[model samples]
Target: MCVLIKKYKHINTNNYNVLENALTYDIQRIENDLKKNHNSDYFLIINDEGRLGKMRKIQRINYIPSIIFLSEIELLIEDSLPKASKNSRFIQILDTISYIVYLYCLEHFNNSRWANRVRNKLNFEDVINLLDKIKNNSNIQASRTNSYGIVHYPR
Candidate 1:
């Protein structure tokens, strides 16, 4: 299995709009960054022979991860955050992100993979409480394509 992760070991906090500031600022900044990475009108797809053999016109929202890619995310997250006896806050945060991606795929694509066990493990609307703190009633406040999503979502 292939996994790519960027460990921000030494982040210059000033250069980034972090969690301590207004959540709105972070959400807007993330949205703007996603806009900058937009792919062209056509997207390349592989054919039955396992080769890059075709290109199809796509809508902007077609930039979403496939089941196989989400499976890879499950693999990588396991490596990064193992099943510990007691979960840490950071681990919970990462798990919330995984749940977000998993649910988004299910809701938007009307597709899901058996290999992705996140939804099975989660209770109904587990992240709902997080919304209570925010004045804006956005169900999905923010989403960023972290390494794998950045590479595979457009394919």
Candidate 2:
């Protein structure tokens, strides 16, 4: 596995609208790329920071199933309390974004031997519920500690 790092300044909280728009565009682009590049393994890393730099790295590498980071999505949902009008639609957007990723994996990789081995582990509902709880400020509990260390989920 290759790890690449890039540096960037922190984002201002007030600019979330711009961030949200960018994320929406990137997610759609990723989905389209996945459709066109069916043979590549697309790995998207979602986090609250370092999104642009990571995206730039992936673009430089010219890798397929392009890697993307959903930092804007996480920031818009987790950094502030949800409000009416503006932030309310975040949940729906997140649902659509994650569903696209999940659907791509299921439909494109289903025939792969490794996919069959790990099919039971791919659950999109868990992701949606986690985002919902974050948006609603509900209690979230630890689900399981996989080889990836500790993982949390909405109970």
- Among all candidates shown, the one with the greatest lDDT: 2
Off by over 4 Å in 2: 1-16, 46-155
Pairs clashing in candidate 2?
A: 42-65
Whole-model Cα lDDT of every candidate shown, in order = 0.31, 0.36
Instruction: Give a tens-digit lDDT track for model 2, residues 29-144.
Output: 44443455554544353442335444443332232233364332211112222233334465556555454434433343342232553447654565445444443332112113
lDDT of 1 by residue, 15-107 (tens): 542222222232223333344454222222221221112112111222323334311111111111123323456555544555554454444
- TM-score of each model, in listed order: 0.24, 0.21
Model 1 clash tally? 0
Against the true structure, whose TM-score is highest?
A: 1
Reference-based lDDT, residue 88, model 2? 42
Clashing pairs in 1: none
Clashes in each model (backbone N, CA, C under 3 Å)? 0, 1
Q: Could you tell me which 10 consecutive residues in candidate 1 have the lowest summed lDDT? A: 71-80
What's model 2's TM-score? 0.21
